[model samples]
Target: MPNQAYLRVAGLSKRFGSGENAVAAIENLSFTLDEGRFLSILGPSGCGKSTLFNIIAGLMAPDSGDVTLNGESMLLRPGMTGYMLQKDLLLPWRTVADNIILSQTLHGVRRSKALDAALPDARACGLETMLRRRPDELSGGQRQRAALVRTLQTGKPLLLLDEPFGALDAITRLHLQELLTDVCMKKDKTVLFITHDVDEALLLSDEVLIMGSQPGRIIAHYHLPQEKPRTLKTLALPRLIEIKGEIMQLLDQEVKRHDPHA
Candidate 1:
């Protein structure tokens, strides 16, 4: 039997404004992510990638359809998923450790207990030595790492990441990409990541969904090989390269569709 979907978006649609001037950010967008699976979404800008994420994260409601997680409706539970944006968005006044446990604190977890729970993830993300430091004291990569730890510490089954590494340098981005996959897999967290980078999506995803613009919708989906320890070496494989090329072509088409003059 096919794997059951841990998270399902069914005929989801979202619109802004009304009447003839109305705009549809998402239209009949649908996809399923299996439990503990890593799915990445690739699309051109204005493709409603972020909008879709916002709806799933329960920050926004869809005009129609529903979003369910673990067989339960997520639409009724806003903030059910752990969400991490491109910027670290850590509280500069709070120490790294404090920031990491911010969500737990909000959920009424005692600080001491939260820290105890956060320690393992902190160390795993290489933030153990800097926990006592403020966000401004850390490098860009360090900050994002702390943000990631914070997201994981929420103990949410699903994670919604919006280009978390987009602003980082190439080297730092690669390191965090590897760290993220390792951490998420070990924790068995389902992730829905949005990225403009095709290689990054292929490297970190169990499956990739390509989206088209002008009322965003899925254009194609590819299930990747179940290769362990997916690294730079994996991206170099001929099959991966072929898949990457195809994804790039699809994205290019979407870009032209959005702007044929370009």
Candidate 2:
């Protein structure tokens, strides 16, 4: 009845250490992202958000459960989806164009073809003039743009973004958020975004999932109206404001629960 999920995580659990020192990072967590949908995850610090990203990205294996795309298992393997991390992680030695096409080259795509595919993305992200420049020569926002271009160049159906704009200044963060939304919408890309910023999640997500700490699990889900393009003005909407307050209260309660002195 619901739109068939393009990506699904089922009964996922993960733990670290042993016996007394054992810590459960994620426990029985599960969710689905529909095709061409944008989903944002929000939670208190140390809520296993990045752990979930790593599991979905196939960078790490869960102690239990599986990640599936189109009903195929995507476990214990990397490169199943395009991932943009908190840091740009661009190679300083490589030029902007080279970095943008790195994924293509790794996937055995010919250099010429990779460049051809990445050029337009680079231009779209305003990196056309700096194509030949090394990562060190680019500004923070520019480096992040190049990283995003590189991720998208992989042509993966699913995109995993873990606070890609968290390191940038406020102005640059907003600019990149808008740029990311525009690019994803144009491409009809499915995205799973993780962020600590409530405003960012509300502005960009088709739906927002709130998580609680100490064995992270979904505490609430909010489906946002997608009829209008999300922008800074969306933050001021009464509905968004109401939802933001609700999420903030939940997050505050989570923090207090974990604080010994509270």
Candidate 3:
């Protein structure tokens, strides 16, 4: 049987400013993410990708339409999902372990219990030795790993990632991609990821949605083959290459459609 929809965004619309100066950032956008599946959104810059995420994260409200999690409205409820943005956003004063358990601490989980619960994830991500180190003491990749642990500690059924690895170096990015895939699968968390990289989207996603500019809207959807969990080795497969080319073509078409001169 097909997987049930765990998250749904239907006819969502958002506009900035008003009257003649108003800009429609998103219009009639709709999509569904299945339970435990990873879905990636791809589009050109200023195509409302971040706008869509902000709306989904409850940081902003759409002018129309609805966002539902587990069949319930998610409007204005920021805690409904765990969100990881482009930056790790670690607290400078906190140690790695402290930062990882920050969410639990906020939720009244005792510090001792939160740290204990975070230990396994820290170890799994290779940060066991640096648990007590502050964010400034760690490398960029290490900080991002710690941030991932913190997101996981929230224990939310859904995760919203907005280009979390976009700032990392290529090698570190690939490593984190692998790590994220493993963690999500093992934990059975549903993910909605926004990214500009086609290969990254293809590697990390079960389904990829391509958005168009000028009032961002999903113009194409591709359901990727998931015979097995994707890894760096998956990049070498002919099917992956084919899908990448197709996605690139679609994106190019979108660009040209918006800018005829190009």
Candidate 4:
């Protein structure tokens, strides 16, 4: 609502191919994220969530739109924000500690200094013991933990995570969700996360945006409470339950609209 939102996307539109074979990824999509707010986007597959993220991360340019961070246009700037994918993408040969500090290493920060800075986060993520091991030596959850530390080590204020915990087991996912919230919120990082799970969105986001398909437009938005240190128990609250139901219904409607037989 303010003139200079922390992150703002205006009239975003992206399409693939041309004319007859063209497909609309996102159409006139727009949203604003305030500083230090954690926001999650819920949408069906092929709803342009990743496409939007790519644009925001400067990995890809939108056909039409503008992405701004702190009133500065981010159109051609890559690496201005932290971007993490579902895959850990850690180098096979690098040790966990080395991998976690890769971003800072590339940015001209000394390895020793980066390691010193990342030590606290590595311990908090339960990666203190595994830091000496390589990615192949770690379990899926451990790898994700290493990846998370790596993302945070970038020291970028805005983080774009695409299903960072989606591949882990239920318990691991839950633990990492809490870890992510605690680390990001305490550090005053603004997060825009993409997840298909309604409960994950509800539990983690300060606000949730439900996206519709076909053209990938926002159809619903829910502002969640400011409660902190939320756990699985918090999802059981009546208000969250009701909102979850509403989100489910809206997603179901979007699915049926895109595929009537679904």
Candidate 5:
């Protein structure tokens, strides 16, 4: 909301390999992500959405880029930000509660204390009864719920969601989107999500950032400007349809160029 950006990304560029083998994922891309808001990154496949997230997460560094968090350069701090992959990535050996507390344990939090601390929040995610059950015992939606709860338990300011609900059914995905909105609001988190689905971006993002293909770069930044608790009925509104049409047009153009036969 202020002049100072919560997350500042200047000249963010990523390159893979060298010379003939080289490929630029994102070339000199720059963007500012504000605090306490959700920013969605939408792009077709191979447009470096995940690559950008990895760079921001500190899992990978850009060849020529700068990332600053809260005015200071972003350092490689493991728990400062939480990242949830496309898959739930739960450990089958551990119980639902155990998986949530795993990060705390790595941070030197003892088992009993970890469980005691994580119990209430995990329960809120509907994993209370399943804390004693294994990951193998849960449904797809349940696994995702546990994964979401686990990601939240870390208390990270930056939540990097890489299509967290992409694998679920349409009905389940809708519920999870609402659930995610509720969780993010309650936690006051700054979230950056990479999702291929346009409707999902429109539904959840405070601002949707579309990226270009090949040498990935930001193409457009559209603010939803809608209040909290955006529902399916809201999607039917004229403004929503207009925005959706705009995004769909961009997507259609990209798809035609990328794959004419599709």
Candidate 6:
């Protein structure tokens, strides 16, 4: 059986413009992320994947829909939901530790206390030595690790990730995905991460949603039966590939469905 769900999205729908110009990004879209579980959403470009992300992050409003958190209705706003983007978005002048505590300070957490609190998790992500270093001095993976830590520092239950490692090279991307899976599990965050990469999504998500384009909707939902402590070796498991095939087949038909005239 599946784990108990902690985050539930009901009848979620979003649109842009009006009348003929209006396009539904994701309509009547819904899914659940159990407490401390990770979910990855994958689809072709223009699939409204990012738009769906915006609504979940509360950066944009849905035409009609609502998100519930840990059984209570969520009142989402900027800073309430910690979002990590494709870029590290780190400040060059600030040290890693400073960046982590900045949000806490803004949320009225005392600087000294926030720093004291972040040390344990920061060290867990391989940032113990780099906390004092500038962003320019860190490797790509290290920088992303900081961003992940900073996201967690918000102390929010959900994390919206928009291809947080998509820009990195293949080798780096794989390395960071494994590292990120470890970090997120340790933190027990409910992650709604977006990705166009199939293997990455399979490697990280406990559940994978395969989305279709324009007037977008969920075409298939895959529940991964694997347990936690997933490693790179998990990718080689036959079951992983089997489920990945199902998602790929859905996407394949989705592309043809959207471009039959082309």
List the candidate 5 regions with Cα displacement exceeding 4 Å.
none
lDDT of 1: 0.92
Q: Candidate 2: what lDDT?
A: 0.90
Taken over the whole model, the C-alpha lDDT of each candidate is 0.92, 0.90, 0.90, 0.92, 0.87, 0.83
Winner of 1 and 2 under lDDT: 1
Candidates in order, TM-scores: namely 0.97, 0.96, 0.96, 0.97, 0.95, 0.91
lDDT of 1 by residue, 148-211 (tens): 9999998998999999999999999999999998998898999999998888998899999999
Writing each residue's lDDT as its tens digit, candidate 5 over 1-262 gives: 6578999889998889899999889988888988988999888888889988888888787888788889877645545688999899999899988999888898999999989988877877878888999999999999999999889888788899999999999988987898899989888899999898988888888999888887898888898867877887778888878998988888777767778997
Q: Compared with the true structure, what per-residue lDDT tens digits does model 6 show for residues 94-191?
A: 99889877789888888889999889878877789888899999988888888988888888878899999987888878777777778787777889
**Runs with alpha carbons beyond 4 Å of true place in candidate 1:** 1-4
lDDT of 3 by residue, 1-262 (tens): 6554679899999999999999999999999888998999999988999998888888899999999987888877788789998899999998888899999999999999999898898888999999889899998999999999999999998998999999999999989998999999999999999999998998889999999988899989889985447776787799888888989999999988888887
* Model 6, position 105: C-alpha lDDT score: 84
Which runs of model 2 end up more than 4 angstroms from their true locations?
Answer: 1-3, 226-228, 260-262
Q: Which digits, one per residue and each the tens of the lDDT, describe model 4 over residues 1-262?
A: 6578899999999999999999999999999999999999999999999999999998898999999999988886899899999999999999999999999999899989999999999999999988889899999999999999999998999999999998989999988998998998789999999999998998888999989877988999889974866788898999999999999999999999878899
Model 4: per-residue Cα lDDT at residue 82: 93
Off by over 4 Å in 4: none
The better-scoring model by lDDT among 4 and 6 is 4
Clashing pairs in 1: none
lDDT of 2 by residue, 44-133 (tens): 888899999999888899999988998888887888899999899998889888899999999899988999888888888999999999
Poorest lDDT segment (10 consecutive residues) of candidate 5: 71-80
Tell me the lDDT of candidate 4. Answer: 0.92
> Superposing every Cα of model 3 onto the true structure, what RMSD results?
1.8
